[model samples]
Target: MSHMPTNIPDQSQIWNGPAGRAWVEAQSVLDDMFSGIAEYLTAQTRALGARQVLDVGCGAGATTMQIANVTERCVGVDVSEPLITLAQQRAVLADSPARFILDDAQVHDFENGAYDLIVSRFGVMFFNDPVAAFENLRRATRPGGALRLVVWRSATENAFLTTAERAVEHMLPDLSRRKDGAVGPFAFAEPGAISRMLERACWSRVRFEPVDFTASFVLEALELYMTRLGAVGLVYAELEPRLQAALVECLRQAYAPYTIDGRIRFTAACWVICADAEA
Candidate 1:
């Protein structure tokens, strides 16, 4: 359950986007989210080993720096210029050889197997054309290399976000109608859409596993996080302030049931798909 890579009508419109300012306003929550994400990538890298790793959406380079610590080469790609700028700054502090690229879009240019391992945290779901996008990612991997990623599962399984959304639907206009933002949660929300896409892109032995990770939401802090970044943030910006406050209140109550021992307990399920190139 995340926002899409926005392709605004013009460059001048970039800063005006709802999610554009989310990075700064929601830094604390994002920091917490990235902490858990870094742990996930660290485990994945230990399994994949220290090699070439490409982070598809390296927001602020938290996980990217972690991968760079172990891998020989790391490149972070993001659509947000502001975020990329921050990532570069952080890279300087970490002293990691990670390069960041800012592009309005991602395309089908695997560049004929240029990477060894490709990774994304909660990225990859919002691409313009996922089949073409995965095909390009397949092209980027060296033969026998791997692709690893995590994405939101269906609403039935992720009540943490779904319940929040349902509670606030009337407060804000339906963001689902935005035509541009990828549909909520898993864009490939269907059962086998992931493996099918990979197979079509020349990947083999694709596998999907359930990802059950807990997320915490400190109501005051998380409210800032939810309405400030990416698509969800943008939707919050579109609403009237009074409605937005009411909406956040609704979420507070909705999410209260999940809080355990002072920490929120929300679990996400994803198909941790892995595949090797044809050897």
Candidate 2:
């Protein structure tokens, strides 16, 4: 196991703790939610004709395993121990050739020129120092290797993810304090900024493709989903009971407009980013 770097201690703690465990428990739902994106990524990997591939922040190994079926070798790297363990178990159960490592990609010691392609799905956005992380990934890629990533466009564009946060904003004033360039999911929301960051890390020919889809959930499970796996869920357990109930009600009303025939659907807006390793 690679030592956890001090720079990402908070992230390490979050993923290794409740967030990791939650992902493990919700792996099935999460997989279903991102299935379309995973398929798109797999198709892109095949199109690239990559033999050895790397999946960064490969939570529960869905995309990694998908890539494995089309590649000679696929390795998944993540910092969350619980998520990594779950991914390993799933891989073994499915007899997949994918391998996983519980290590931070930011500072992991990857072999130089080992991979022909690197891919991620809604990952690679959490690094404290994204430039340093991309530089490490660049070192692991062969000359002219390709990189593909799917990242959220913005909170407003991804209402499926931010509805709960917005619903409870009055209660949690901090939710409205988001800014550009923060080291979170929306850190790469700005295309120009991220393109420049990747270039600084020595990746070339960066480009972005817009991806829009609907994320659907059974209406019955909406509340549980929000309180358990959503961003607001991170702090849901600490709130007073009255506040919690109020939040649940707020979310219920907020999501009502999106409900139809026992299901709730919200738009998911993301950017499919592509780049090349410096030759």
Highest lDDT against the true fold, candidate: 2
- For each candidate, C-alpha RMSD in Å? 4.6, 3.2
Candidate 2: pairs in clash: none
What is candidate 1's lDDT per residue for 1-279, written digit by digit as tens? 222245424421443244545765565576675467678876787787848888886767777888887878788887777778888988887777888877632553436777888888776765655666777777778888888877667766766555655666666455543221244346645647667877877889988777787666565575665566444566676678897788777877876787677666666666566778776
* Global fold similarity of model 1 (TM-score): 0.83
**Candidate 1 clash total?**
0
Q: lDDT of candidate 2 vs native?
A: 0.85
- In candidate 1, where is summed lDDT lowest over 10 consecutive residues? 176-185
Give Cα distance to truth, residue 10, candidate 2, Å.
1.8
